[model samples]
Target: MADPRPATPTDLPLIIVAIATCLALVVFTAPLTTLDAMTDALGLSPGAQAWIMSGMPLGAACGLLTAGALGDTLGRRRTFVAGLWLTAASSVAAALSVNGLMLIVMRVVQGLGSAGIMACGLGLLGQVYDGQARRRAAAVWAAALGAGVAVGPLIASGLLAVSGWTATHWAVAAVSAALAVMAMSRLPESDRTGDRVDIGGSVLLIAGLACLMSALIEVRVGSTGLVTALLIGAVVLLGLFWRIERRTGNPILALELFRYPDFSGATLAAFASGAGVLALMSMVPTALVRGMGQSPMSAAVILLAWSGVTVVAALASGRLPERLTPRQRVIGAIAGCGVGQALMLAAGTGTSWAVVLPGLLIAGVSNGILNASLGHEAVQTVPPERAAMGSAANNTARYLGSALGIALISVLIAQKSGAGTDFFDAWHAAVIASTAFSVLGVLAMLVVSRPRGVVR
Candidate 1:
């Protein structure tokens, strides 16, 4: 069929992208709420569990590095459909895994699929909408993305309560399969660019990230020599990757984007946003179930306040004055996150979820605002030709932060509460560590030196 009438915010194409992106993003955290049950069933140690949680985001960071090139080489629609199918297959495989390691590996593959969908889904939206219409569409997309992060645990908890931990994976598989069919029937294909692929850079980045995360996770097990070796390897590989990007034509990542202060600041804010928000999401269920002795359904209901407010705030952030400088918006939003996390820190072990409600509400709203501002700033800071790379870089930072954050939180909690220490005390310390990341992000933004001719 000749392409449908001009794309609008409510068009079927945009709707499809929104839903796919939401599902893909949700996969990052859906397993968290159900993790306690999953661990029991799979015979997972704490170290194994942390790796399982970190695996998907690390895989996603790798996928973001190269998914753009894959989209440019393969037709976008083809890549999207393939990604959905891959998600379906991996989710099913995850559901069937009999061991912790197998489940972790499958989750990584699932994340790879998720990354492909997220990268291309946005690209599709950009291609379809422009001008003010594009702005509205982008706002809707950002809201959906935040909604995914906020509500993923509730969905996971509900599924686990009804049909056990495997239900979550099976449900994801079913949804992805259905989306794949929808894409085949209704989605329009974007033209292919066949740009020179950046295979070497992509490989180096993935290997470096994997080694780094593996070192972090293994550190929890007190594997000193292995951790040292892995950490050194990671640094060497990442250093080489940076050197390669500086020299190569058609680099996977353009190093020049960092020269713009707004771009650098916004990217760092995005990273901290991901680390603080997602680490909280991943750990809350553990606190409720393992620390406080609550059921998954009850945990979900308690978290409802956090997720609901986030959705509302995310949509509201889009309505703020367009004249607000990206720097101002990002600085305010990240600072708010710091304040909110500090409030959460005050809610100690004996306090009920109600005691933490105010903090969650504040943090949720700030997260929404940060999400919108970072996305807008990331785009505005880059030249039009570099927009795709900018988005990829922003997401890469976010996912990488998430992986690192989860690993760090796990290690900190373990180290703080060794044999004989209270679990809740350790949990409190971990929360503080996440709060520190928000402060660090704020400080990084404060020091960002904007380039000449750039808007503050």
Candidate 2:
């Protein structure tokens, strides 16, 4: 067969990145509606409710480590197909869920599938593309996924306007199904190999993470006993995982990887980037709707603005990595977003959506740049044989950041977002927090630079 076009997934990097965006689009939009209505429908207390809400991130974290390692070993196509199918199935099940617990269970499954796509996709991409092409592909994928996420709310609002909220899941499920079929036919297989799937370590990791997530999601929800117990259990399980992985010949995470400061710094920077942006993605639009008394569609329109800027930024990211030093680009992106978030906070306080929108635009652009820039840094740090592990580690930082993002924002909103709460005030607080995260991201970049020598 003639070699496929540059953009085709017959090139594994292209295919996996395409699949990642599709998968990300499906559920990310669902949250916009569900978070508002879910507690009422689930009949669960507020704290207990976000458990299912947070479960998506938790599940992804659990599935990513194992999926990345095995994708290299078993075949990326095999895992990609399986993960897409499973994600589609879970979406259908989620649409039919009657209670909070049932939906959480289904969401966990959905997350598991998402993790596979995310972990396997990056690893496969690492193997399929060379230096500059890989960076470009990563940037394009980041841009595409940002677009999908941006489109989700607009699509969800329209679906909810005509049909029930549950119908939206069906719509998302259909998308996943369509992507799965395309994936089976088109996605190129991974070229590298790795150790066997670490079943034991996988279980421990999941259990530990589940416990930790559960503890955090409930800590402020009035469950001191259960939350405390779950946290202790999580700590023990994670400790066990560390000990086991250290002794095992093939561990899920290679400890040696962290010894390289660039890998570690890039991962840390990625994590902070995820936290700041993901949290903003969730809270900012809601603030516009509830605090400012804007229409749902209006709120979504603002989000579209956030998404729009990201696309422009991502396309430009391939150039930044090539044109600027990694440290310069990484630190600049973080600090730039920090300035944006600070403006976002200041504007959100009064009539700043109009003003704050600019900040969000900058923030989105930074995010686009970072996601691609970080991936490039990650793939370069490790040997070709260990690329999947590196990919998994890279994604793990992003997911871990996302988990923290959800938790931090949830706590902030819950604590401050009562009936008496000033809509814009809470919005301001959230933006300030986002700004703080961006500052920390800057710190991460600066700290790393002092030791490594300035990229400039």
Candidate models: Cα lDDT each: 0.75, 0.71
Give lDDT tens digits, candidate 1, residues 58-160: 7788777577556655656787788899999999999999999899999889888987787677666666777655655565667778677667777887788
lDDT of 2 by residue, 1-456 (tens): 112356543465475466566556557566666566667666877655666667777788777778767776777767877777878899899889988878888888888888777776666676667666677667666676677777777776677768766777787678778777776766677664555667788789888988877776776674679988998999999999998888877777777878787787888887887788766776677677656667777887887667777777877776543347776777888887776677666544435458657777877887777766676677767776667677777777777777777677766776666433455556667777777777887887777633443222
lDDT of candidate 2? Answer: 0.71
Give the Å error, residue 155, model 2: 2.0
* Estimated TM-score for each candidate: 0.89, 0.89
Could you tell me which 10 consecutive residues in candidate 1 have the lowest summed lDDT? 1-10
Query: How much RMSD separates candidate 1 from the native structure?
Result: 4.0
Candidate 1 segments whose C-alpha is farther than 4 A from its true place? 1-10, 72-75, 184-188, 290-293, 416-425, 449-456
